[model samples]
Target: MKKILLSIGGLVLLVIAVLLVAPLFISLEDYKPEIAAKAKEATGRDLEIGGKISLSLFPTVAIEVNDVALANYEQGQNKDMVTLEQMALELQVMPLLSSEVVIDRFVLVKPIINLEIDKTGKPNWELEGTQAPANETATTENSESSDGGSGAGLSGLSLGDVRIENGELHFIDLASGAKEDIEALNLEISLEALNEPLSLDGRLDWKAETINLKADVANLESLMNGGSTALEASVNSSPVNFSFNGTAQQASAFALAGALDLDVPSVKGLTDWVGAPIERQSEETFGPLSVKGQLDLNGSVVAFDDVSLAFDALTAQGALKIDSSGSVPNIVAALSTGVLDITPYLPPETSGGQDASSESTSDGGGAVQNAGADQGWSDEAIDFSGLKSVNADLALKSEGVKIRKITIGVSELGILLQGGKLTADLKQLALYDGQARGKVVLDSSKATPTTAINFDLSGVQAEPLLSDSADFEKLLGTLSSKANLTTQGASQKAMVSNLNGTGDFIFQDGAVKGVNIPGLIRNVSLDALQNSFDEAQSTDFAELSGTYTIQQGVVNNQDLSMIAPLFRLSGKGTVPMPPKTLDYRLEPKLVGDLEGQGGDSGAKGLAVPLLITGSWSDPKVAPDLAGALTDQLKDPSALIEGVTSGEGGVKLPLGDGDDAGGVEEVIEKPKEALQKLFGN
Candidate 1:
């Protein structure tokens, strides 16, 4: 035993002497080629050492290597995969006597690492003949037992300080054409225990933004071994500031609980700082934001509780969860707010701040001009791709909501998303002193996106609703309506071309201005019709109801009816949505006829068929003389007897022109008998 001990001590002294004296006796550069050859044989990559290599023996033994590089993979475009300006490892001399390896400090300077995955989805780090994880694990265990190893190799291992200065890491994905670079990274760590806690301080340059961070970890070894650890972290920067106190686990056995705080001066500015900026049509400041939340996460699921977010003029609180364990992510949330203002998200209001009622003129001229100018419904394509991004169910409530002149009071809305479909349910909506309920669903599961809306609104003001919804302000009353509609399209015009729906509407105690049906049906001239069709000549109705069906964007109203004191009107019409036009024929007759019963054109007391035709905003109403003539002559025998023999009925007065006598001759060759009956 003494001989063995003496021999080991002598060997240790010899190694110490060599470490101290070698650099002076020999040039290390002479062995560089052999060292490079061994490294290449082991790693299958080129190794270059352009700078000095040195060894020291003092309070601590140390080795330093400078200006080293490794060759890249065969598929990489660059020649070098990694390069280092300097690297050093220091060891405690006392540990060597006990057969223990204890590191005093580790340092790296100006290191650059490049990592990549190729188009074939193979990472550059993957090596040929690499053992599977199970095999690797068994091999490691067998090797350790055979070598009679202590834990972590030569047991009593300890490390004090670790420092990295001016480092860079780059990751590239050739398939996705994505490149991420982290530059000017520096890290400093102070260790308190070998396995329990680590104090970290770090900073980096990202997208020209400086990020300073600090973190403390307890049980870092446990985390590395797929277990839980406690963490506290904070980040400070110009674009955003964030902090968290949490328990974090590994990705496979994921678990997290934390409190998070975040602040941002402007969302747009923050996005720009990250090298991506949103493109929006409206020019407005998007946000000055603050957020606070309690987070709990397990596996592929994440949840936030007691969450509050304040951005711009909107303040909201919610509980939110996202589950990504499935084929696609699912998100569920419920949020509530007070006085939500969505004005900035809309297109700038054209007739800004003008009273809604003032958009129309009594003469109906301005209505046409305005409608033509605006041509409602934008032609720009609406991207619905976001609806398919995740499956979600969300509920939102607000005390009040406003978007330009449109306002809603006490509203609750729910949104559901799944399988590339999104449904928005207005479970409760109070607007314009009324209530509304509806469901709107957008589905992209088909070849093209399709939408369905089923809605009911009651006790709503007609004029304001129309003005806000469709820029129409011609009618005033309380309205009730129900509609079920479906359409498929990528744009407004496409939707119009494929629209299909059914709806019914009832207006109570309403008045429609700018046209007089009775006067126009009385065979009045155009000038006379326009004169009496002024605002003062509006027709008042006790009840007006219509049931309509829409096919291919053309709305057909076949059961249109109106009740008034002096007249009862029934009409039918087609409103073609794409052209923004209306065509209708209304048959209006007096309340009582000679038989003391209401009648149509034949039973008479000025039952004229009034035709309304024109652009929707400026329709023209006139007496259909040609149609009346056609109806009058449907029985040619009756027309011959009424004009010639005066047996069918007395001929209705034809016109205010002197050609009244010539009217009979105009139909045929100057019928002498008809001319004599008219005394022509």
Candidate 2:
């Protein structure tokens, strides 16, 4: 029995030895040529395969490939040139149980690729080309294999570890003439093709002249029959050091959709990376337009936190939102700041043009004439609906600057400027001590642009406001004024309709400055004029209050009063801006009933009556002395018959009875004759 058992044991050992050593005769070197031929046939290109194979007594087989390279082939190009590096596959056990191959690891290293795009934006790789005979045969075989089962081609392969080192990827932007290259990438993947689900992890490093990036990806998978892919990735770059992780889903070819959340600590570097300058502007210095902030973006939705931009003396910070998905996108942004000098960015005005104050002419004369008629405004009409929303805070400061906000709808009637605020600090504006605040709204819906203006003007010394403007210095002494005004109109012609406002005017001690009634009256006291002419020139006072209203081109002043002259005045006139013309009539009345009072019964006791009637085209001022003289001397010609004409007063002749009409009908008269003879 012992002898029989030993012989049985020996037989069992012999069978095991044969099973382990059988693969040794299957030399991998001998199979290299056939494998290379098959690979060439499959890819339509030449293939080179090299590797070492080993068999162990444990009944295991392992193979390692040093390198595999493929050649590029075209109808007339050099077919021997290497175009791509073939993947090196390493198998630890071949034909596991004699039916499938199990790959323990695979590595792809330092592969170079080239791509070219033509002027027509087509890629060279997409062009049709001839295929080698071996490649055609291999492709036919692969198709037959696929027909055997849905995944039969890849079902026999299993991998434990896969890695790629120092790989490079590049992208060329044909439209922008830019090329982006990513290099120094390392990746590791473990996949089992026959398994239910697949997984992968990769890491990459990218270097460029102005930027550097490193990223990591993990837990990648394709689920629901390739309808969705899930993964987590983090990317870090020198410019905008931030990271994002998310899941993405795709719907056939319609779209690639996903949502990603991110956190960013600082965007200063990011701004710099994008070639945005960082600096500030001073009164004597100019600075970069810099901005920094934390932003969140999900698909088309974006949000900002603590964002600011500095341009010269202006700094603006705000939050805004845009929706760019519709036919007409809209934008809603709110920004605020203390002061801003926006003059540098304003459009250059045409030469020899009328200023803001000049009424708009049919030829586009006012400031709003060519306001936004430029390419910049036209390009801003792109739809922004794809952008979500934003909220922000901001500030700006500048001298001689105008802040304007205008909105125009593509299909709307006209442009609407919600408002505009202007500040002038130039010496000419007297803004050194001058400051003005105002808001103007324009409604262009009408055939003409209608404007509403509300403004507060202060620190305007009358002398300066009128210095270069007119002859105010000749009549009124040094003067200053403060006024609050509101007006609405569609055009110069329409401005006369229902215009009303009030003003407080003050004149310093000096000779009457302008040609107005108050300026001409000087320091005359009615009582003193009646008492003796002595005290009339000694008194000095300055101040006035008045309100004016306009309707149907006629301006009327009901509360015109002055202290130095101590007189009350009423006036009416028409002021049209087109041809720039003014016509008015004024009646001056003494404050008290001097005729009834026990005042001096002299020329001063008589009412100091005055009348003004003239067109701005050519104005004339004279005294109403017709009733002052007795019947025999009542005629102005008789009163001035012997008086020598001087600079202060003059006299002229009167008409004969047949041709002379009523008192109002007398035509020619000397201005001085009326002033001296009537004492007004």
Candidate 3:
């Protein structure tokens, strides 16, 4: 029995030796033509196979090809369009025993694929007029056959291990002049077949610039066929080091189910990647961005959570969701920052003196003055013409943004701001004082791009408003006011012409300094003329009430009056606020009691029934009043010196002088006294 067992074992060993050594006698060159013919029949192209086959062991096969070239046979041109070089394959030993061929390993090296799209936008590779092969058939007889059935059996090839080393791939769009190249590529793959389904594990390494990426992918085949695949990748460089992990089928689907981790040395670099316009000339630089996030994707909808990004210049972190299912993609994103420097994004000023002069002259002579309190306006107001909606939670720490031609309208109020600037703690919408807090709303609905503002301002200094104007020199006291102003039209000049608004203004402890309204009134005083006022009132007393209209810096008052002991006064005038000049005509009336007191009352009323007058710009009160008083009292120096030295009140002295003279003389001279008092 032992001898018989030994003989059986020796026979089995001999059979294995014969099976392993038989392929060594089979010449690999003899199979080249058959391999080429099989590839051509399968791909519908001319194929060149230059590879050596190895069969040193039973049921195991290996093919190493130096180069394999495929050509488009439909073109009549004999040039090879696609080439595979240094290709190799290794097969499992078990498939040979089953009369079936299954590849366990496949590898490609330096494969160059060239594709051309003609002017007609047709790719050269597409089969022009060929019919597709009929559906494949399966039979038990072919399955049992040793030669792997028929010539059409190549489709059944299954690979278990695949790798590409030191390869280069390029995509060129011929018609668009666009080219994309990937170089220095290396890849390794391991896969297995289960229930006729392929499962793969992959590792890839690539480089571009100083950046290097290493990635691991799992379930790669399933991922290509609408099943989930998981991937984790890490990038390293001097300025950047980041990692990310997620599951995705395609790049577009990354927005749905991808998680990204970033630790970059510069936020500016990230901004550049995301397409924000940051000026290259700015001196300000941002530090690194540290970000981590996860994305949930559902077709065209994507939602992001656990998103956080930080920079040295600002702290920005937020969640965002995007919907691309509509005609126009809509993005709803919320971002908040601890601090941000947005100066780089601000509009650049127009250079050269010509632009400055043009802007200065465009206001139609309305003057702008420097603020006494330094409201922190570094540049001129921006022109709000083409601005759309702005939705950002921003904290700004610079000066402030100036807006020109701010036309605003609410239901009851309308205003036009020529050149106004406002400064606020933007994050809180509060002034530095903390008491003043408000939001500004601008509406440009009427004219697509025209700006209209509706704002509620409180606890603001009134002096800032007057200081911004060219006319008034200074204003005293703190002021708080709320207004709603709007204007129509496009530009500052045009808006003023078409401007219409109504606002109620109130002042507390407000006083105008370096402005002498009394002097102006005296220069245009009606005391020199007859029938100015019907009643006899003290010269020291005066009251004014009427609607005044200003146009092109000229003020016109239609109904004005003045009362004096000897005469009543009335007049009309054109007063220019800037440059401070006026022209007027006055008529004086004798008082009834004064006429009853003496026969000369009619003479007083008759003197200078109308006086025409003009005055200098911004005249000094003391000198102007001295001139008028010298003309009326025949002793100007006394009254002028009296008021200038603070010895006596000028208005009361003039009133006493009016009582001393007859009604006629008093009425005539009081006008001179008024002229002296007002420096007109």
Provide the TM-score for each candidate, comma-separated: 0.78, 0.42, 0.56
Candidate rank order under lDDT: 1, 3, 2
lDDT of 2 by residue, 349-434 (tens): 34333345432222221111222211111212222222223211212232233332211111101111222212221112223244
* Model 3, TM vs. native: 0.56
- Model number with the top lDDT: 1
Question: lDDT by residue for model 3 over 536-641, one digit each (tens)?
Answer: 3223322222345555435666554443333444556656533345565444433322222122322222112233333332221112233333443555444344
Give the lowest summed-lDDT range of ten residues in model 3. 405-414
The candidate maximizing TM-score is 1
Badly placed stretches (over 4 Å) of model 1 are: 1-27, 73-77, 96-101, 116-138, 141-157, 170-177, 347-386, 447-450, 487-498, 516-523, 535-537, 578-581, 588-608, 614-620, 625-680
After superposing candidate 2 on the true structure, give the runs of residues whose Cα lies further than 4 Å from its correct spot. Answer: 1-87, 91-103, 127-161, 170-176, 188-219, 222-231, 245-680
Prediction 1 TM-score vs. true: 0.78
Which candidate order results from sorting by TM-score in descending order? Answer: 1, 3, 2
Give lDDT per model, in order. Answer: 0.73, 0.41, 0.47
